[model samples]
Each structure stands twice: as structure tokens, then as C-alpha cells.
Target: MRPMPRPAEYGQWDELPDVPEVPTSRMGDLAVLDVRERLIRLIDRRRSEDARIAELEQQWRERGGVGESPYEVSRQWVRRQTTEGALMLAGILDRLLRS
Candidate 1:
């Protein structure tokens, strides 16, 4: 591929136009978005961790663990984890909303 072309006058950061100032209300709005994104990421992390825990339980069962089948135990464990995560997320969201 050919080399990309650069603008002849694109050298000075000081020459760049001044960025517009954001209003305080808009900053608050962005904070709400940030909170929602964080919540989503936290939820995804919890789900992945719960899945990992279930997988670990399965491996343990395959290694002659004495208990109910891996499927049953993992299901119950994942359920508890999900419930706890949900409660935690609710509290976090509540606190964020109150801010």
C-alpha cells in the first residue's frame, strides 16, 4: 500500500481551535452515562465469573467429587451468585442515582 498523505498545515496543537466549554448540567448527564456503562460492565463481569465458578465446579465433579451432580450443584451455585450480584448492583445503582 502507498503511504498515507498528511495535511501540510497540521503541525501545531497551539493553532488548534479552542474546545468549547461543556455546561455543568451536561457534565452531570455524562456522569449518568458513565454510571450506566460501569453497571453494565460490572454485570457482565459477574456473569463471566459465575460461569467460571460453574466450570470449576464441573471440573471438580469430574475429578470424583462427592456430591450431587455437577449440573445440579453448579446451577444452584450460579443462581446464588446471580442473586447476590443483582442485589449489589441494585445498591450501587441506587447510590449512583442519589448522587
Candidate 2:
């Protein structure tokens, strides 16, 4: 069987540009910082959403009971998913940093 040419050999894709390598320690630090920032943003977003939900719920209460709000139910589902994703990401990052 004949071997197929690699993309680089055929010029199908341009070779990547040379870039200076970052130190492992520096890279790890950067990864940790990035994760922390992302987590913070995620938490802040969730908090804002929770506050909005609370406001809406209070307003609903002010008015006589009128079944459940579809929007609120969907928002709660989204919030739950986001929380789960954040927890998983944090766990993976923790394991990576530990190693």
C-alpha cells in the first residue's frame, strides 16, 4: 500500500508560524488565572440571573397567583445547566493543576 501525503507536504494547509514558547510554569499560571476569571464571570452572571428571577417572582406575587411563568421555568433549567458545567470545569481544572 502506498502512503498518503501529509497536508503539510502537499501545501494543502500552510505551515504554522514560528512562535516563542512560553515556560511551563508561566503557562500553568496563565491557565489558572484564565479559569479563575471565567469562573468569576460565570458566578456573576448566575447571580444577576437569580436576582432577576427573584424580582419577577415578587412581582408575580404582588399580582394574584396566575399559574407558573414559562420563562421562569426555562431560566431555572438554564441556570442549573450552567451551574453543572461550571462545577465540572472547575473539577477538571483542579485535577489538571494538581498533576
Query: Where does model 1 exceed 4 Å of error?
Result: 1-28, 68-99
* TM values, all candidates: 0.45, 0.59
- Clashes, model 2: 0
Candidate 2 lDDT trough over 10 residues, lowest sum: 11-20
lDDT of 2 by residue, 1-99 (tens): 424333234332212222223346757576766765666676676677768877877787777757765346645554665565577657655655676
lDDT of each: 0.51, 0.57
Q: Which 10 consecutive residues of model 1 have the lowest summed lDDT?
A: 9-18
Q: Alpha carbon lDDT of residue 69, candidate 1? A: 51
List pairs with backbone clashes in candidate 2.
none
List clashing residue pairs in candidate 1. none
